[model samples]
Target: MNTPIDLRSDTVTLPTRAMREAMYHAELGDDVYGEDPTVNALEAQAAAMLGHEAALFVVSGTMGNLVAILTHCGRGDEAIMGDECHTFHYEVGGAAALGGVPIRTVPNGHDGLPALADIEAAIRPDDIHDPPTRLLCLENTHNRCGGTAIGPEPFRAACDLAHRHGVAVHLDGARIFNAAIARGCPVRELVAPADTVMFCLSKGLGAPVGSLLAGPADFITRARKNRKMVGGAMRQVGVLAAAGLVALDQMVDRLAEDHEHAQLLAHGLAAIPGVHIDPSRVHTNIVIFEVTDPLAFLQRLQAEGVLGVYFGGQMVRLVTHYGITRADIEATLVTVRQALRAA
Candidate 1:
C-alpha cells in the first residue's frame, strides 16, 4: 500500500537522518543543573537567532508559551491577544489555569494582526477593579488566520503600542521561520519588536521534539524556574536538543519549499467545486478552506488516503511540511477534488 498523504499538521513530520544521528551521539549532562552542553548550545543558538539575551528549551510550543507567560505576568494580571490567535483557541488555557493570568481578546484582521486601536482600547485602566493588562501576545503565520505572515512594520507597530502602555509583548512565533521565509526577511527582524518569543522546532523544522522560549537573560532565568513548576525540566535532555540543533542548521531555509507547496495547495483547492479559500491569504505552509459538508468531506478524504483535520464549523486545515513533496500535493489535490464530488 502507498503511504498516506498526511496534511493534518507539520507536527507529524519525522526527524531527518542527520537529526537521528546527532541525537544518538549528543553530549549529555543534567539540564536541570545547567550542565548539558548540547542543550546549552541549542538554547544559545535560538536566542541569537531571535536576537534575545537568552532562551529556555522546553518540551513543546505550548509549554514554551506558558513559561513565557508565567515569567511576564503576575497573578491576576491580564494578557491581550488576537481572538484568532493560537494561544486563545489552542494551548488549553494554561496561562489562566496555572498562572492566574486572564487573556483579553481583540479582533484579528485578515493579515493576522490585532488592530492597534483595538489593542489600545483593551488595556485596563489604573483603576483597582480591572485586571491590569501586563502582556500583549502575537502570533506570526497565525494558525486560524490561514497562516498569514505578520510582517515587520505592523508587528513593530503593535509592539510599540503595547510598550507605550507599559505592557510587555510576548510572541507565539511557532512558525516564525516560515513567516521570515515567506516575507524574504530575517527571522530576527520579524521578532525584534516583541519582548519574548516562543518558537517550535518540532513543527515545520521537523525535529522530533522541543521548542525554545527566548527573551532577556533575567526573564529566561525566571522562566527556567517556572518550567520546573510545570514539570518541563528534564535531565540529560540533550538528546532532544541535538535534533533541534540539526533542525536549526538544516531545516530553516527549506521552509520555502513548504511555502511553495502551500501556495500550490491553496490555488488547487480554490479551483475545486464546493471549496472556499483565498489563495492570496495563504502566506506559509498552512492551508485552511471551507467545504459545504466538512465531516463528509473529511471522511471521504481520509478514505482516499488524504488526511486533513476538520477545523471548527465548516473549515478544514492542511499543512505542508518537510517530507511532503510537490508530487504529494498534486495527488492530494486530485484526491480532494474526487472527495468533494463524492460528498
Candidate 2:
C-alpha cells in the first residue's frame, strides 16, 4: 500500500513534464478580451482538428455542457440524451436549474447510442402541451454505458434523425479521443455530424484543466456570451490552455495504451468470482463491473492500494489513463486476486 494505483478516474492524472514545461513557457494575455494568443491558438487548433468552424475554451466539462445546453435550447424546451449521460447524471442538473431546459432521456443501448426508434419516439411534436425538442446530445465513448463507442454509421443515423426533426446535435465528447482510437478513426470524423461538440482536455489527455466547445462560428459566438453570463469568463487563462495545447499535440495518440490497460483490467476482473461484466463491453478506457457489495469491494481494493469508483451503489468503475501503466495493471490484477481470496 506504499504507492497508490489511482484508477478512480482519468481526470486524476497529473500533467507530464513536457506539459509542465509548456505551461511555464506559455505566453499570457487577457483572455476575457479574446487577446490571449496561446488560448486563441489552442482553440483554433482544436476547432480545425475537430472539423468545426470555431471553438471556445471553457473551465470544465460541466461548464462546457451547461453553456451548450443553455445556448442551444430555449427555456422550457427539451434536449434528448442518454438516461445515464454525464450531462444528466454528473453535471449537477445545471441545465435544469440555470437553462430551464427539460432533459428528455432515451434509454441507452448497449453500444451507447439511443435506440433509433426510442430517440424518434422521444421527440416532441408541434403540440403546445409538449416542450419543443430543441437539441439532441450524444456522448462518444459513452461513460456510463461501459465506455462503448458509437460507430460512424450509428452516429450518422442518429444525427440524420435528429436533423430531420430540426433538432441540432451537441456532443458531450468527454472521451472522444478514446472513441476515435477504439474505432480506428479520427476525432473530426466522429464529430462531423454534430452541430456542436465539446471534448475534455482534462480527462484522458492529462491536461490539468479545460474543455473545448466547437461548432459553427455563430454558435461559438453565442456560447461565448453564455459562458460569460454563467461567470465562466477568465483572465490570463492561457496558462492552463498551454497544457491543453500539449495534450492536443502529444497526449492524444497514446490513448491506445489506456484502452489496452482497461481491457486487460476488465478481462482480469471478469475472472474474479464476484465480478460480473461482459468483457466484450470493455471497448475503450473504462471498465465497469457489477459487484454484490460495492462498498466492501471498494474498501478491499483501496486497502490493497488499487482505487476506483463505485456507481449506482453496485457497479464499480476502473478507468485507465495516461498515468496507469501495464505494470500497474499487473499489480492491480495481483491485488484483486488477493482481495478475492481473502474475502
Candidate 3:
C-alpha cells in the first residue's frame, strides 16, 4: 500500500533536507546560560523579522503563549481571547493552572476576529469584584475557525482597542506566515500592532521543533524567567535552532503552494454531495468541512490511504503542508468522491 496522505495537521510535516543539514552543523552551547550562539541568532533573527526588540525560543507555541501570559499578567489578572481560539480549546489551560491568570472568552466572528466592541465590553472596569483584564489574546489563521486568516487592518484595530483599554495583546501566531502569505502582506505588518507575538517553527514552517516569542526587550527579559519556571530553558539546543533558522529562511514563500492545494481540496470537497464546505472560506492551508458521519467518513478515507482529523461534532479538518503535493490533493478528492458514492 502507499504511504497515507497525512492531512491531519501541519504539525505532521517532516523537516527538509536543508533543515537536516543545518541541524547537523549547528553551533552549540548552554542556552540556559544564554551562550548558545545558534539559538541566540535564531532569536535575534525572529525578533527583527517580527519588528520587536527581542525574542525567546520556547519548546512549543503553547509554552511560548504561557510564558508571555506569565510575564504580562500578575496572579488573579484575566486574559481575554476568542471563544474558538486554540488557547481556549487547546493548550491545557496552562495560564490559569500555572500562572493563576484566568481567561475570558469573547465570541469570534466567522472571519476569526473578536468584535472590537465585544472586546471593549469584556475589559474589566476598576472594581474590587472583577479580575483585572490585563491581556487580549489573538490568533492569526485561527485553527478552530477553519483556519481563517485575520487581515492586518482589522487585526490592528483590535490591538489598538486592547491597548486603549490598558490590555496588552499576545498573538497566537503559530501559522502567522500562512496568514501573511494569504493576505499578500509582509509578516511584520500583520504583527506590528501586537504587544507580543508567538510564531511556531514546527507547524507550517516545517521545523522539527520550537516556537519564538517576540516583543519589547524588557518584556522578553521577564518572559525568559517565566520560560525557566515552565522548564522551557534548554542546554545545547542549537541543533534544533539550526533547523528553525533554515525553516525561516526557506519555508515561508512556498506556503503559497499549500494554500493553493487547500483551495483545490476545498472546492473539490464542496462538490461532493455529502460534504459541506465553502471553498471561499478557505483562505489559508486548512480545509474544514462538515459531514453527516464524521467518524465513519474518516474511517473510510483512512482505509483508502487519505488521513484527516475529526474536529468536534460533525466537523472534519484536513491541513495541507510541506509534503502534500497538488497531485496528492487530487487523489484525496477522488477518494472522497468514491467514498461518498459507496455510502
Candidate 4:
C-alpha cells in the first residue's frame, strides 16, 4: 500500500469492511420498479433523518443536485445560487445545458451562505423578459468557502427570503454530516429550512456510490423521473444502497473525529512559516490554507507523499476523512514544515 496520504478530497475514502459486509449480504430487487427493499430502506432512512416526506437515491451529489434543479424549474427558468457554489463553478453547467435552467449567482458570505439582499434582488418579477426565478440553492458546509458551515441565522434568512418570493430552496448538503457534527446539531436542523436537500453517501461517509435527495413525496416522484431520464435509474441498486445503509447508521457520528483532525492540521500548519490560516473557522473536516507559490508548494509536498488540491492561486485544501488517521495528520503537519523550509 502507498503511504502517499492523499488528502485531495474526502471523496477518496473507501468503504469500510463493515460497509462491504452489508453490501455483500444485501437483499436486492429491481429498483426501476421500486421493489429494491434495501434501496427503499435507505431512502426511507434518509427521508426521516432529513425531516423530509420522501427521498430518492441517485448516483452522485452532482446527479442529485441536477435532478433537484430540473424538478424545480422549467425550461428557461432561473436558479439563484452562490457564485462559489459547486453547481456554478463545477458540475459542467448541466442545469443550463440539459434542463434549460439559467444560473443567477449571488456572492457568498464568509460562512458560505448567500447574501440575502443579493438573493432577494435577483428574484425576477412577473415580467416577460426575465427568466422566472424558480429556485434558490444552498450548500451547507459550503465547499469553496473553506467548508464554512451554514448557521441558523443565515440559513433561516435565505430560506425565508426565497420562500417569501414563492421560490423553493434546495440544499446542496453534500457533506452536511460534517456540518452537523461540528455544530452539535442533527442534520435535519441544518437542512429543514430548505424545501429539498441532497447528501452524498460516497464522499465523507465512505460508501462506494449513491446520494440521497430528500423532499416532499410529490417532489421526489418528479425527481425520480428526472433521475431516470438522466441515466441514474439502476435496476439492482441495492448493492450500493446497502453500503449507504451502513454509511448512514455508522458513519454520521464519527465525522466529529475527522473535524478534530482537520482542526489539528490547520493549527499545526498555521504555526509553520509561509503558511497562513485561521484555525477558528475550521469547524469541519476541510482545512483550506494559503501558501506562497502553491504549485511549487504542492510539488514539494508530493515528494514527501502528501497530496491535496490547489484551489486557485495560493490556496489549497486538505480534507481529513475516515481513511486518514491522527498519525497521518501529524506526519502531514511535519511534512508541511519541511516543504516550506525547502521552498
Pairs of residues at least 3 apart in sequence or in different chains that clash in candidate 4: none
Model 1 TM-score (2 dp): 0.99
Candidate order, lDDT descending: 3, 1, 4, 2
lDDT of 1 at 78: 98
Candidate 2: regions farther than 4 A off = none
User: When superposed on Cα atoms, how far off is each prediction in RMSD?
Assistant: 0.8, 1.0, 0.7, 0.9
The global C-alpha lDDT for each of the candidates, from Candidate 1 onward, is: 0.94, 0.92, 0.95, 0.92
lDDT string for model 3 (67-168, tens) is 999999999999999999999888999999999999999999999999999999999999999999999999998999888999999999999999988889
**So what's the TM-score on candidate 3?**
0.99
Superpose all Cα atoms of candidate 4 onto the true structure and report the RMSD in Å to 1 decimal. 0.9
Clashing pairs in 3: none
Clashes of each: 0, 0, 0, 0
How do the predictions measure up, each by TM-score? 0.99, 0.98, 0.99, 0.98
Cα lDDT of candidate 3 equals: 0.95
Please give, for residues 138-251, the per-residue lDDT of candidate 1 as tens digits.
999899998999899999999999999999999999999999998888999989999999999999999999999999999999999999999999999999999999999999
